[model samples]
Target: MTQEKLFASFLLDQTQGVEIALRAEQVTEATHIQGGIQKLPGSVDFLEGVMHLRDDVIPVINLKKRLGFTPDSYTQEAKVAVVSHFNTRYGLLFEDIKEVFRVKPEKILPINPALRTDDQAISALIKVEPGKRAVELLDLDHLFAGSNIDYTNEEPPHESTAKQRTYSRYVVFSSGGQEYGVSVEIAREITFCREINEIFRTGIVAGAIELRGRTIPIIDTQALFTNSETTELITDEHSRILILSAKNCSVGMIVDHIKEITTVADDSILPFPYSDNDNVKGMLSRLDGENTILLDVHNLLCNHVEAIKSMANIGNHKEQEHEDSDTGAHTVTHHLITENCYLIFSIGKNFAIEIKDVNEIIENDHVMRVPGASGCSTEVINLRGEVVPIINLRNFYQFDTKKKSETNKLIICSAHGQTVALEVDKIVTIYKQEQFYATPSLGNQLRSKKDTLDRLIEFLNDQEINEHVLVLNIHSLIRNHLQLETTSRQAADLHADQHADDTITEQAKG
Candidate 1:
């Protein structure tokens, strides 16, 4: 007997409705259409603009229009269903999303070849019991056949190129009754205002909050601009934290609430007449007759270095306590000044590598495919004058192969004087003042003997939560996993020279 399969049902139109169902496994999530949509030039007719979904910018397609039906007016119940096809995610705009239901094999009926048309989107139909309406199963592979919609390569306009002006999106919020805007590139995420642990109550530093595994200092924007002292922190339903990244560190700023994510033209911004504050970059005049103060995020974060350092100290202290309790091991306290830095990135999951092991980080561009090099690396890129091998981390880790997008990054790392590039999904962030711990017994047994993951590191995510990230042992990875020699001629000569120097110093002391 065949097992039943689940399907997510939706309506194309409410009045003259056409019910459709997509396989539940393909649908990632259904979310409200927020921040509206930004139309793209030279795009297909049915390709509705793009919308920001958490960390990704997805292209929304009007399902009604794509199916030769007029799109209905968007109402409060309208939603964008995020679906995955070929490991690439896209947003399907629908009038309304119905419930997910199961269809038994007996009720599933395939469409006849004689009745199918050239543009047949319905592969099968589910006959409901009694008098319920039949649901048409959607064939996503056929619907998006030969479609070439790329939304990830849009780049921001450069300041020097005045003729090629493009629209830049900004996340706008209110602070101290005045609205301010920050570029979407720097704005990490918007989260609810959590209770802050007051480590430093001076100036605009309201306190600190544990986000993921790291402690981030919360800056009171009202106090910063007003030149006033820190007041009693208050919270309400509308309060939010606008997490901003600068200098490879994240800091949360308290805002009244997130108003909207909108795009502003490059020429639309006017220089601020007042020069009292360097943080205020420009002014954006909106249609509602209000001027939004565009802020320089880098300057704002750089000004609060002291507060940021204090938050890092708090994180280290808490991490030490956690480690001691878990392993019953009392480790020596390490100061923040001497702490090591790491580059955090994601392949399928989060992983960390020491920053010192990295030579540089570059974009995954112009990679040439090589034949018969499929074991560890199958692609190489010309970095400077050297032909550097590109290791697909997903393939090496045995993760599902995903379609590479423009946002993918390449990390140039070296071990034993041999350099290679690691292809990753995206660079998450650079973490400082972090500690490394030994991998647990269970992890050691599960991992391969030649695997690179021998240690664990912890970091905080955007949602103020902490998780363990596996640290890559680059030396072992090169020697054991890649079967490369542990030492180059130059490295061996340097090691011998160091030993000779030590012996001569010992002879002099004797």
Candidate 2:
């Protein structure tokens, strides 16, 4: 018999009730934060602040604010739930935790589409008792990454077995006679492609289209599918634009036509072939013996834009390589590993950094704003009494700038012989050599464990790392990006320079 699991139910406000369906082993700590949370200056509203919990400083998140609810007054009755997964930890604030109940997996149901949004944080719904409103299930990973999740029933799946299985609903479309589908959750709404102001010389950007009083960039799906610079898409009567939301950015994709929404069981989705380079998640075989290509819209957009940027900088990157070697910015041969472990982390949906030069992972390091450092070089954090510069790789990498929460972490490492830190959304997983295989720089892809590296490349945009973690060259990161001094003494000088006005005033008075 399958073991029943325990779920913790809680109230966000006085009205709506929610539940976290994770196993008991998943929760690390659940208690009222002593002395309350300390607010950080300039932090986002959803981030309450950092709290010293046990040995680590944990970021406490305001669940109400995170869910777009009105801010609730602080009270001692509130509780903090610390959950850990993939070696990453975060805290979720609750107004009042209700009850812990054991439930068989089959009892949980997908929330009705009529009552949910594709961008909602709730992952599933559970019926605690008869005729009661189902408690929404929260997905902590999506919540921490500031990702929108859809957990509604579009078309109910055919249950073939007694075992519990998770399913996703997708909207099918076709272009160039080829069938394609995208998760209905990410694909917000479908509408006719009209009044699109084509931007000449903008590469793949078809033009700006007004979406609910806001102009957003639109990309041609044909260009994305073919991995080309641009494609002449006939946006006549049948052409439709799929509005997609990933992370904090929203984009529109021009498709021939959206067919219908269908539910497919998770197990039926097969990985794409190794040689295929398109942004396909999997292949779903239908009853009529036809297969539809599952599209990963987020990766499709990211890869197309990145490829254009890479091609534009072809000559510049080669020139920088020689300079990097001369300046000793190249990673030392001794630091390279053939068979070892890597710490994988993500900045946004598109890229995951593989840390080969990781020195240590620490939390609660107080970040001090650095003087004269603009853009990515924003602050210097004190790590074990040593000052290390903090670089938000998202800013350096030109990713979508979402509201950052306190749960974000600093990855400490040595770059150019200097200790530096890279701030990432979350630490995904620590993958050993056998778990992942390295390849020549390809656009971001995830490898599934069930299949070999070659066969699993087709499943690149599933957004979930299975057995194969994409190995990002840390050497390139240290050499090409992050211009900062390595030593704490040099960082201290920068910090002192930030307060030089006060020193001068004191000297004049003396």
**lDDT, model 1:** 0.73
Alpha-carbon local distance difference test for all models: 0.73, 0.59
Single out the weakest 10-residue window by summed lDDT for candidate 1. 314-323
**Candidate 2 local lDDT, 295-321, one digit each (tens):** 776667664443232222211222223
In TM-score terms, candidate 2 sits at 0.30
Give the per-residue Cα lDDT of candidate 2 at 92.
74
Candidate 1 clashes between residue pairs 3 or more apart in a chain or in different chains: 211-464, 212-464, 212-465, 212-466, 213-460, 213-466
Per-model TM-score, in order, reads: 0.38, 0.30
Question: Which candidate has the top score in lDDT?
Answer: 1
Local lDDT at 320 for model 1? 48
Question: Could you tell me the lDDT of residue 66 within candidate 2?
Answer: 75
Candidate 2 residue 314 C-alpha distance from true site, Å: 27
